[model samples]
Target: MNYLKPSETLSELFAGLVVVLTVTLAASVLGGGDEAGATTALIGAIGANTAWGIIDASLYVMNATFDRKRQLRFVHVIAASPDEATALDQIRGELDPILESVTKAGDRDQLYRSIYSTLAHGEFPARSGLQRDDIVGAIQMFCIALCATLPAAIPLLLSSHPMQALRISNFLVVGLLFIVGYYWAKYVDVNRWFAGLGLMSLGLILVGVAIALGG
Candidate 1:
């Protein structure tokens, strides 16, 4: 099961990388030493980011499942409506955006019937019985986050100078954040350069917060 779209994978990768770098940088600043326990810092960053990614992805899955249930309930309600016109109106209100480009009357009618039938029969026609896509998406998110940890940590693990390693990690993360933002903007039809700057600023803000809180 393919869990993540290509764009989503990139977004998660950069986000996780920024988070790991921010926290590690904050830790280095607070501890104030050239060799401020690089091994412990590396392990801590990896562990913290991995756990956070898993938790975040789990929450997303729960919310998505709840949303799916809500959509099904809405469909069931529409199907139970006494008037066909009213049911069609409800469907239009809920699904018009998705079906806007589908101009064929037969196609629209067929789609409405399919939805009504699926809801009435309690068949919930998802891709998999257990929502495999959602599960896979969560796992993909977790893996992206876990993998991001290594890049930020490798410098800390290898270098004797904590500040230098932190600086390098910060630069790498900042650059990645800009790239992530640029692509995200392009995906959403916005100004790519501005979005890149915005994301980089957001990363800086997060780093500032981490430092202020003594990470």
Candidate 2:
């Protein structure tokens, strides 16, 4: 049920943050320095990112559903065997990597029986049931994406000068991207400084593209 681990959540948070920041900065730049322009930029960025987040989360849920169906099919195949011994053999053969550490005969037998019963009865056991975690993870992802818009939009919402707001938002986002990249690299056992710079460069590229496209 663990659809997304803590590290994955952090990585997603940073990625979403950078994306929203770039878009908001572009919006601020394109709009003129006025109350109406600032309001438009802030509202546009928030609304766009919110919609994107929902769409992204929905796709994740759909993909997870398909994947779960595939896994159930595999289970059905194993349960279709004629005899207990054959079923166990099939399970061991197909899922050896998963059961390799289960050295105890009793444990293996329990696992085999559990899988066979669940598939044969068309009732998945608690642990093997449809994962609620996927739905929860999707919601969390959506929230992260939506929340990311706020930081970039804050300056635009508060400041009268669109250009000044854009500059501050750009700087804030770049700094955040570097910090996220550094920690992410450390988590993955990579070179932190290089990763930081790399992500920062990527952010800049995205900003350029957004501006060129007249976002």
Candidate 3:
């Protein structure tokens, strides 16, 4: 159902890619990319990232639920306000930051009034729970994370030498980081060239840190 924003989906993929890339690089450097070390690194990367994917997916659900609860609370507050002015003030205070980038001040004011009218007169259920769409979305998130590791896996499966496979995987992961950054830039309406290069650099720095810590 595409519950995640483009940025969020990119972030998820980036996280998984960095994780496995770190494991692979750390093992290559620390263990001299030996047969046993390479095998261990592959296994560890898959297992650890799989666990991370599940954990991140669950966290997404929690965050989504929290957002829903927050919206409901805001609605209830607006409904219980003493006057229309007070309700509109509260709504504007809570929503202005998000809408400000895309909407004019007059447009935002009108939208807020419309929202105030609808929410003030509406009925909402008390419980805030996960929905079917939420579950589907979480599953989608997990799958994206898992798929991010496939590029790294292919080199490992095809290359006979551990060092060769690790180098290929490293290149693949770094390229992917840039690709995702490019898309992220386009999504956010920025310069794609700078975004791609900047993200590739940032991702390598982050992976180095993670490897150092985990090593």
Candidate 4:
């Protein structure tokens, strides 16, 4: 399914890494860096990520359905409008959020008119319902969220020393945060290194806050 955008994938991974870091750090703070602490952290990370993945998947399905309905509604509204101006207005309202910042009013109007022309001739959907593509996208969302736990979780499992394992896990998650941010910057036109370091710093700050707040 061509459903999961790069931005969405990056967002899930970024959030998941922050959550894992926060959970592990809180466990270490509360459990005193013992075997128990490592065990608690590992379980917490797994459970949190799994739940988050499921939640995101559910939301993906919901959004897919809702978006379909919205599209149909949009088409109907365009078809029902009394004249071209109203239909153009409807299209402008829809396009404004995306084009407002980067484009001039004239450019947006041209784009809106172009879209209006196409939509005027397009047929509205007879019905809206969930499809296979939606399900596939949901599964993709879930997989991305769940897989995000692996880099940190594997290190925790591999080391015999609990403190060392926790340290390694933190390091791995920070690196993952940096990597995600580096890719994220590509879309935003930011300096890659700065974005990477900034995300890592933000992740650490969030974990620290979680620990301080008693997790």
Candidate 5:
């Protein structure tokens, strides 16, 4: 499955966070019916924005490391001699587990080297390639995060009808979760309903928590 790039994933999260914070801040400035309500909204907005920003920045750094590794691999493959390429392939095979661990940590170098060495050894070389799992994970992250944001922002934006907007946004987010999850499931040949429902549940939980803490 072709999914979001690491940078793209971070960017999506960042943009959504900005939207949420902006709306929340706006609501605070406009003033709610009570001082406690306004203060609570402001605090929640600040906390959510700060937390999301940190997470987004961390993801961006990880993705950057991953891209750097891929770039290095490309360079290695292009420059290595046939014998050197063979040696690299053996080394990469030995380092496969380490590479997987590094990738999980968002450290791409080992994996990049491994993949490039493998590709260089192949009779037919690919100009560019990405693992299906990595792409799928990125897509999942983006969809899940974006879906979780709507319930928070929509309600804040419609001050006159905050509850109504919140409910509508909740439904919208669920529908989006189902669509994205279904597509992802079908792409991977999994059970579409289960995947969609699982993602929808996660979105609901996030929204519910925000609502509870927000009050």
Candidate 6:
């Protein structure tokens, strides 16, 4: 399975919604102009999500570019070899450790395959295949780190009642948080509800403090 599928990115994107929702709710509870607070929360959430997505996309692009360059060097050495078998074998020996290291550093399976296919005449020369579960799991983690703010953005922007809107946004955020946390717990093979709620609560508290401070 591809380690960075659209589904994976989507899951994280949903998780980001949770972050926005939770913050919006907190801001409301702290008291502020309903329309203005909601608008602020909305703006903040959208900004956060965009920033996170750009970061993830940037990492993928940068890493792929770097890996492709390295692969080119390998291809050159292998091509120049007198014996194809020996050259391929030598490259294989060197590539395995490198592949493993890249996997460990981040889920580089998809990027590597792209580079390999481009250079190897459409042949994907991946020595290892990533499990579907691993890719989904990594995406889930990435979302937990990035997407928890989607719900908050709308509330901040549209709520006429600032406090109410903020509260609504907070509740929505908490709910999304629980959803992401539950999925994350399941991915890690842990207690789902407890882990999920625990994470949601922590996020809520942090945002609550920020709202109290007029953030």
Tens digit of per-residue lDDT, candidate 1, span 123-176: 654532248678878887888888888767777777778778877766777787
Question: What is the Cα-based lDDT of residue 41 in candidate 6?
Answer: 60
Q: Of the pair 2 and 3, which is ahead by TM-score?
A: 3
* Overall local distance difference test of candidate 6: 0.58
Residues 147-191 of candidate 6 have per-residue lDDT tens digits of 455456565556566776666666776677677667777666789
What's the candidate order when arranged by decreasing TM-score? 3, 4, 1, 2, 6, 5
Consecutive 10-residue window with the lowest summed lDDT within model 5: 123-132
Q: Give candidate 3's error at residue 132 in angstroms.
A: 1.0
lDDT of each: 0.74, 0.73, 0.85, 0.85, 0.53, 0.58
Question: Mind giving the per-residue lDDT tens digits that candidate 4 earns over 152-206?
Answer: 6897888998988888888888899999889889999999999999988987888
Give the residue spans of candidate 1 off by over 4 A: 5-11, 97-129, 213-215
Residue pairs whose backbone atoms clash in candidate 2 = none
Indicate the residue-level lDDT of 125 in model 6: 43
lDDT of 5: 0.53
Q: Write down the lDDT that model 4 would get.
A: 0.85
Q: How do all models score by TM-score?
A: 0.79, 0.71, 0.92, 0.87, 0.44, 0.52
Model 1, residue 37: distance off in Å is 4.2
Return the lDDT, model 1, position 28: 63
Superposed model 6: Cα runs more than 4 Å off: 1-26, 29-31, 68-150, 156-159, 201-215
Per-residue lDDT, model 3, residue 137, is 83
RMSD per model, one decimal:
3.5, 4.7, 1.8, 2.4, 9.9, 9.0
Q: Give the Cα-based TM-score of candidate 3 against the true structure.
A: 0.92
